[model samples]
Target: MSDSASVDIAGLAPAVKAALLEVLIHGELPRAEIARRLNLSRASLTRITRTLVDAGLLAEGGTRLMAQTGRPSEMLILQPQARHVLGIKLTGDVLYATVTDLSATAVASRELRLPSPDPADVVAEIAGVAREFSAEYPDIVAVGIAIAGRVRQDRAGAVVEVSAFLDWTDVPLGAMVTEATGLPCSVENDVRALTVTEHWFGAGTGLDDMALITVGVGIGCGLVVNGRLVEGAHARAGQLSHLIVDDAGPYCDLGHRGCATSMLVNSAIVGAYRVAGVDYEGVVAAARAGDAVARAIFADAGRALGVLVASVANLTDPQKIVLTGDGIAVVELAGDAMRAEIARRLDTEAVDVDIDVRLWDFSEWARAGAGLAIRDMLS
Candidate 1:
């Protein structure tokens, strides 16, 4: 293959590369249309697309007839399979993975249940998975791992600041994974990784401003402002769990009474009923079966969530707010109350804001990991 076939796209200017990928993402477009949308001159567009085309990332497709002039302009196409990326989601006991082409299409996936959360043991398992995958898909260039909690990352490696789910802190996760797998690795907060996928491929796509709300074991939010994910000064910009919703509500070990986390998190709900080992799914079923107490619990939780979401809407004014995670069904069960609370709490001018609810699984979170790799490629 020619050198251009393996060009280092990371060297391109941000605007030039972004414009090219924008066209690639939106699909084959005529030169004029691409330039007009990107606010670039024909000459500038030609220069940028030329570099991409030469790098085997973009190609010229058949001409498109212009509506007004009846003239033909060649269209540009993205070579999605030019490269591949791997994504993994690391839970305390399970490791879920997926391989995706440049377009973020999953070609294969895997799941591994871990007997231990030891960093070395988990890294070894991941290396084994990467090796098995490499035999069939050699183009895989990078891997992304998503875990719950605070993560600090740089080109050299990543450190898991704290992970309550895994009971890990200050772990050099990225370096360990990279040394074992012989591939570049990125570590990101699970919810933030999901937001990355949503921004590029899911409900949040094409929007410059949006927020993703996840309600599972905990409540988390991810913000995208001006087409970029906001990590904040402390890398905790979207920590919505602590947002106080009711001063007299239940309290967690953190001692925050009536906070969204205390009122809406899985543990809070489970603790409320004092059902021995009852999972969130059971709570959903009970509420759906006309259990008044269960319904009331969900109603309160929903109201808490609604207040948290409305606070985000009022402050950020995002174009869309996406809700997902294990607690989504509970939110649905509490639909009327949730909606009413949201409508009542939101500023009158923001009442028309769009709220989207989606269901996501571990594989989807893994896909978000793949999205991190794709992000590196695009940036």
Candidate 2:
């Protein structure tokens, strides 16, 4: 339609635009550099930036330029404190929350034990956490909440199906959180929100396509393609957890046998450990001790994971594959076999793909949540 609309920041209403500018207000950049980075013309960037400056979302500064540069160019910086947002991560056992400024830096954080896993109670607790954070950061504009269980759009962002994991079905969670926190709120699938964070600023930042596999209590994969996180029409795209590696390995919660998760997930390994009469923690210690049986269990999971990684690399053709999660504690024992299996499963030259195995701590997850809030502001 018009020039500003053509800037490619879709879904960015004026409020969102002001929020985005506020995120950049602390860091000054030249007009031409900003245009180049954001893929907008200098004229358009200048106009919108001036508008943001006038709105107090950004500040303009200048200095003398070299003779070839004619004069020192004025610079634009984001006034990050102009606004802020809150992020909440709810899981089966823990409630991790953060208050972040427009730049996505953590201002405050809280990790409290969950009172109960009940959906309403959990949502209420989440809402309470948001309220608490908002009271501390009075300028907070919106909130981004992430849930570990399945969250989907029943009718487009209405959070119709929160899935059977936490028994959250057709719950008006977004509305509830908004009403409780007095801020616009949006709930996200935890892994997908984490993926969005990674795709934009972490390991996958510049790659047009990549994937993150979280191997923990559940096997999760998040895929990005063509510079956008893949959100399938059904919002169930990267369910690589149930890729059916064995077709008969073990019964999975998905009612499938030998799924990737069933055969290779942490619980699955615990099952394997039990078969050998060892506890899960004992198994990790034994693997560290190079116990053959413990090592084999880790190897089995790694091999299964390797095949799945090969599948993702082949199917998505992503340039990078990042492996992270709580499962990585034993990954060292399984990594070699997994690598071998990945090589074996590749049909072609494997695209010369690079794989990064990482261990995600609470801070990274919190940062991902903050990044989600930042992304919400940008959009």
Candidate 3:
């Protein structure tokens, strides 16, 4: 196998890149199937696959019998381990890191406590981690950083327009990381990164439209429409946290009363419990053990979340709505109320959107960074 760095992925022909992506996302497939999926002639598909194979990005694997033809056909598979990327998810206090292959499969992971949230300190930490991983995994080609922020990608690099959690504004994070580590770096909003991971490999795979709503320290939403991730004019398309849920509920930092964030976020749930020093998990456990007060708080939060989900469905009409976050247990504890609210608000009777609850894992967020790196490589 050759080094993946020898292949200029971004310089490849568009059709060849598309063919490679199809194989990467769908796994091994017969030439006829790949040609059909990509709308390529058999000759064109052969040429594309040949280029990828020569570049060590693809391989011809074991044969599969074609049911229609009663003939054995070789399958083209992605060379996932040919190269690797470092995926880092940065929060205020911790940095979750993982190394993933071309297919965005996590092979190794680690966590580091942030000594400080200063941009310089964070960049240094990221550089140190990237160097360590590159030394261990010599094929590491790029680094991707995911943070809760508004990121803008331009000719220069990815810029963090704002990251309220880290008090970062107008930070040139991508360029800094790349310069620090001697590798290409991509920066993305953590929620959008997760959405990309879902669209490419997780629950939303193969779907043209889907929504992900995360309820945790903060409420966030990511949307995919018409097979594309939606980044609005200002890169703030999915800011549904402040969407009004009730006029009489609690207030968020933005002073919005009964907004989705105010009603459904971890802090809000904990605050509503009104018990000294009790965290969100404690409240969830209490609710599970049949504590009325805890149950009521979760039920209210669940209903608010349902309203948000219904609103997303009514507006975007996604095929699925993924509800996930560290605080997602609220959905299980107050599922009945949430479903009732969703049933009441959805305008369409013929179309029932699938709501999937995924238990949160910080490693998944790191994998999202890997997904972004994969996308950057392809683009």
What tens-digit string does per-residue lDDT give for candidate 3 at 70-118?
9888899988988899999998889999999988999999999999999
Candidate 2 versus the native: TM-score? 0.83
lDDT of each: 0.84, 0.72, 0.89
Rank by lDDT (best first): 3, 1, 2
Tens digits of per-residue lDDT for model 2, 248-363: 58788778887887777777788877765666667788889988878987887888888888999889899899888877765677878888888988877657658888776765
Pairs in steric clash, model 1: none
Task: Count clashes in each candidate, considering only residues at least 3 apart in sequence or on different chains.
Answer: 0, 8, 0
lDDT-better candidate, 1 vs 2:
1
Candidate 1: worst-modelled 10 consecutive residues by lDDT: 1-10
* After superposition, candidate 1 runs with Cα above 4 Å error: 1-5, 8-16, 37-44, 66-71
